[model samples]
Target: QISEATDAPEAFVAKILQPLSKKGILISNKGKQGGFTVDLDKIEHIKIIEIILATDGEEIFTRCAFGLEKCSSEKPCPFHFTYKPIREGLKSSLSEISIYDMALKTEQGEAFLKI
Candidate 1:
């Protein structure tokens, strides 16, 4: 839908779609009435973290706070130590959740609706 609507390159669209499909995060249909739709039931089982990591990568939050190479605990960058906790927290939160939790919360009106 995104690709068709946006007129994006097929390769680019495929790149974006493949990972989601492999993770069962997206379902695509074929034929005259074929299209794409989110499997809400399965989606409920996914975590925000998995989606983030799937699309972005686990290192996204921890990649050298200042974009420096070889930043680490022993030879940390000036900002590394300070950024560590924040990065870890973000990563941990993402890795510890599922989409189901989000759906249930949303259904119960316990989750915030984003525009």
Candidate 2:
């Protein structure tokens, strides 16, 4: 169901799902009648950054704006200063928006979940 919703390949989705299950973001059952299910209340309490870190790792918090391999505070890229605040703002915003809020927005037709 989750894979169908994302329109992503099962193999790829499974790879991501495994980690989430391990981290208690998802519950996986083992049996013929078993599968995975999300605890909406629990998920609602989880910050988006947790999911990002679990799935994409910390690179999302540290990637260079110009995609430079050596960019940093010392050897900063050309766009470093300009991009720093924007990235920080993104991180802050993402931290505040929970899965429940996103779901509510989409459910109310105020957001797009499929696209």
Pick the TM-score winner: 2
For candidate 2, write residues 1-115 as lDDT tens digits: 7678778888888788788788888888879976777897687888888778788888877889878989988999889988988889989998999888887887799987578
Cα lDDT listed for each candidate: 0.75, 0.83
The C-alpha local distance difference test score for the whole of candidate 1 amounts to 0.75
| TM-scores for every predicted model | 0.66, 0.85
**Once superposed on the true structure, which residue ranges of model 2 sit more than 4 Å away at CA?**
none
- List candidate 1 segments past 4 Å from native: 1-18, 38-41, 105-114
Per-model tally of clashing residue pairs: 7, 0
